[model samples]
Structure formats: C-alpha cells, structure tokens
Target: MRVRGDDLVKDLKKLRKGRGILTSSIISHVGPALGEADCPLSDRELEILRMVEEDRTATDIAYALHLSAGTVRNYISSAMTKLDARNRAHAVRIARDQGWI
Candidate 1:
C-alpha cells in the first residue's frame, strides 16, 4: 500500500508526540545497560544501525549498501542479540545510548 506524503507526515508527528521523542528516563534506563552488554554488531551491523537511525527501512538499507535484505535482517538480528534488545527499535535505542550509532 502506498502511504500518502501528508499522511506520513501526520503519522510522524503523532509518533514524535508519543514514542519518538526520547526523554531523560529513557536515556537513563538505556545507558547503563549498554556498558554491560556483550558487543554484537560487526562493521556491517554498525552500518545498518546508522541507516536505521536515519529512518531507512531494511530494503532501503540493503539497496543502498548493495546487500540482500536477508543479510540486513541478519545484521539487525545479531546486533539485537548482542545488545540483549527485545527488537530492532530497542537495539537502536541501546546503540544510540552507547554512542555506537
């Protein structure tokens, strides 16, 4: 399904008001956890994380980096495992909190 530009902007605004804005408590919670976790992101993983930080989707990242979507997914999965994250969003949070992304 194609998302209209206006609708996308509206959704982003809603997200910013809700979960997208990172508050102090969220930063505090994620900070300490990062130092204690085992490092799981390889060079490729780091790249994927950076792209995700820029709001790129898996397909976008794969296409930009000339990698397969499966490979990008694997990198994300490995990063999540290493960071002990529950999901991709969580992993990005951890990575950002640690200044790893």
Candidate 2:
C-alpha cells in the first residue's frame, strides 16, 4: 500500500472506499437459543441425508423406508433449506460435518 508522497492520501481514500462490507457464513444453531430440538434438521431429514451420504438413490431410500419417492425428496429438500445448502450433496456434507447425521 506504499504510495509515492502526495499520492498516498488519494490512494488510501480510494482503498477505503473500495473496502466493502464484511460478511461471514451463516450457521444454524440448536439448543437453548432455539428453545427446542438438538439440531436444525428433524429426525427424518437426518435419516434421509445419512442414506444419501451412503450414495443411495432417492427411489431406493423410499423403497427401503416404505415411503414415497416424493416424500424422500421432500425430506432432502427440507434438509437443504434448513442447512442453507445449495444441493443434496451439500446438505449431506453440512449435516455430517455438524454431526447431525
């Protein structure tokens, strides 16, 4: 950030102006703060993501669980929303990393 003599003031001003607001990752917490539940995801959502982590297809999981495929997908989608995940894999990753599943 060293600028020559008189240019230092102008350079610093420009740098300060360009320094945008800071942001951080949003994490969902459970426990007393939430007033209920141990994790953000429900038991069913955790179960589905665990199966997903094992590389099971949605239809396969539905068959094994005696639930509809659409229901399984709905659980996955709900988990994704709760974990702020971009996709099914991301949801699993987040849940696993948090030890939720």
Candidate 3:
C-alpha cells in the first residue's frame, strides 16, 4: 500500500520524538570551512550540498528531492570531482571553504 505524505511526516515526527536528541555535529563540521577561497557552486549543487550539510543520507536526499539514488550519487560525485575532493567529507569541506554552501 502507498503511504500519504502526511502519514510519512507523522511517522518521522514520532521517530524523532522517540529519539529525544537533536545533534549539532553538521554545523560544527562545516563551520570552519565556511569562508576560504575556491570556485562557486551552482544553485542546484548548492541545494544538494546544503542537504548534505544537514547530515541527510544520499538515499534520504534522493527520496526528499524525488530523484533516484544513482542520480544523487552522480551529482555528489561530480561535485567532488569538480572540487578535487577526496571524498564526501572533503567535498563538503571544500564547498564550505569556497562559500558555496
């Protein structure tokens, strides 16, 4: 059966409430690199990066953005390559350093 969006939201809220903890590691990790110097990010790339900064999983981002996980992965990979980043964490750091996200 298909679940409605409201139902999904309610379920998510319930799960979050059960967890009873809101962490702040995402900002902490990306804060230092917020301003340095590098290339600029496009609007779509920035959106994807922001979602990444929010600590959302690739699968979650894909679902939220109505994209295939493969597509999300490709965007991430392309971003990483353009930034000459070694990995996801490095890409985020580079993007933040460039003031792209």
Model 2: residues with Cα > 4 Å off, grouped in runs: 1-24, 28-38
Root-mean-square deviation of each candidate, in angstroms?
A: 11.9, 11.5, 15.1
| CA lDDT of every candidate | 0.71, 0.70, 0.66
* Cα RMSD of predicted structure 3: 15.1
Give stretches of model 1 more than 4 Å off. Answer: 1-39
TM-scores of the candidates in the order shown: 0.61, 0.65, 0.59
Evaluated with TM-score, which candidate comes out highest? 2
* Cα lDDT for residue 31, candidate 2: 28
Model 2 clash number: 0
Estimate, for each residue in 30-76, the C-alpha lDDT of model 3 and write its tens digit: 33457434344567677887888899999999999999989888888
Q: Where is model 2 poorest over a 10-residue stretch in terms of lDDT?
A: 21-30
lDDT of 3: 0.66
